[model samples]
Target: MFLDILLYIFIGIIVLQFIYYIGIFSVFSFKKAEKKNPNHVPVSVIVCAKNEAENVTRLIPELLNQNYPDFEIILIDDASSDETLEIFEEFEKQHSKIRLVKVENNEAFWGNKKYALTLGIKTAKKPYLLFTDADCFIPSNQWIAEMTAHFTEKKTIVLGYGKYKKIKGSLLNKLIRYETLLTAIQYFSWAKKGKPYMGVGRNLAYNQSEFYKVNGFIDHMSIRSGDDDLFINQAATKNNTEICYSLESFTISEPKTTFNSWYRQKRRHVSTASHYKFFDKAQLALFYACNISFFILAIVLLVTQHQWILVTALIAFRYLFTWISVGCGAGKLHEKDVVYWYPFLEVTLIFTQFSVFIHNKFSKPVHWK
Candidate 1:
């Protein structure tokens, strides 16, 4: 009887996993992208930098030459000890629309990018604010126009896609790209279903009025990270938030080549998860737990009862179904290469994410830019 009970428990977990996959299918299957009209609302593009002189040297020109009309680039110099300030000064001279907001490194104000970004928003003359990082590059000049086009009536928030550049073949590079796509799948799918929880800071947009209405991240100011997600978590609504998936709207950033750098980057991002609203937190936790639990139980069922037929069928069904649904999502997101690695990446991603989630509990908060 004890052996039979153990078998039933494992079977139940696999059933739960199947149900979760079905939920993903339902969300993706019924959703269709909406048409957007071209909108030329005056926008302020904000870039906060600590010491990104090299990157901005190549990045600022792209901002100035965008295909949109009436947009200004707000480059905030957050106490850079490098050539960042000098470079921006030169750009400001050449381009009349470029505005510079400098944050002095004082004992009172140091290391917080959120504070610097808030200053940028305050200095912006435009009604709309579109944010990206210094290390990121626009795919095309149409980036601004495409993102702003989604700001229809009542749509106050726009979430845009940001991708990492593909590097020389390595396990870490592939994993990093796959992880980014996986994150995109979750947030985008949820947003499509009218339950947006967060967005990437690298490419996101919102109205200037909404910033002051929420008091501008005052609650989470102490947090060094989450200038993007935490703000949106508080500000986004079913009727107010919309996502822009146009190919030209995306931004690409250089990926961390070393494992240590990537690990630290992910830790800072995961640290913000604790601050998410309860419902959103529980939903994300459930997805991770179910995914890991499903595979663990399948292994036990195979080992203990030699239930080869049952175990094989369930695992096969999961792998095949997930490949199909996530493959479709990958295609839509321009992450087609990740589809080939989904099965192998499943085990790798779950274990790494579980480790990071546990580590985040004891980790000291790190500075973000």
Candidate 2:
């Protein structure tokens, strides 16, 4: 009887979190672009590439051809071992707006990417700074114009979505898309409710002034891989952050092929999750705990033969709630097809969370690719 009561209480808590996510999703509408005067605000697009020779050669041309009135591309080669610098030199020959910056020696002050971004930002002559990864490709020519329009006096920080490209014969591609969609659901829903906690570094924008105001990751400098999210968490005000959902403003990146590469990348990311504020950490913990408890309780109920109908109903309710919430988010991110893969995705998420927990508990310092 005590175990049954405890299970009931856990079920109730999970239901409450389901409703909370739903309410958050329904409150703030996805951001849409509006017509505005052709104001030429000076803007700088910064991209840091380490061993991304092919991506730089291909994506730089698209960034240079943006329809924006005024902007410059600052490409930083972070001591890459590959021919990244050689490729950048070839692109710089054709485009005047494309400036190549190389970090030959680490000043021994910051992480490789952070150092590269700091160097690019220092040389930037614009008031607004946009950060994107080298592997990402912007969707449209007007992507910058559409994204920048949302940066008014009210909204200082902008978070945009990035999807993974679908590749045939690669289960890794499917998994990457599912992971991205799930992450977007949590962050986007939170952003919608003005309780923004995290933002993706791959496609994020903020003012130079805001960056300096937060001391530019001074608190988390020793820990790498959080320069984007930690900085936003420190700098963004309640009314200063906005999320962009338009297709024109979205980005797409190729997925890693091997599981080992993906595992290392995810492990690096998990280390920073603990650095979030107490309340934010509590919320995340509750969410993950519910998922784990649900799975465990279902297995116990099956073995003990305790109120099978009630247990099945609770399980169904939880599944329905997650599917709807995750489905809404997947739609907004343009991965609607992945919705059909939700059952497998949910199972995968549990294992993924367990891996993250173990990694955080036992893993050593990780290096970024």
Clashing pairs in 2: none
TM-score of 2: 0.93
TM-score of 1: 0.95
Candidate with the greatest TM-score versus the true structure: 1
Candidate 2: segments with Cα more than 4 A from true spot: 28-40
Across 1-369, the per-residue lDDT of candidate 2 in tens digits comes to 876886787577667657655666545323443354434567899998899988887788789879998899988988888999999887878888988888876667534577677888888888888888889988688778766877887787888888788887676677778888877777777777777888887788888888888777778777777887777767776798877777787888888888878777788877788888887788778787777777777888767868888777877887777787777767667888877878887778678868877977986657665
Clash counts for all predictions: 0, 0
Across 181-218, the per-residue lDDT of candidate 1 in tens digits comes to 77887787778779898999999999998899899989
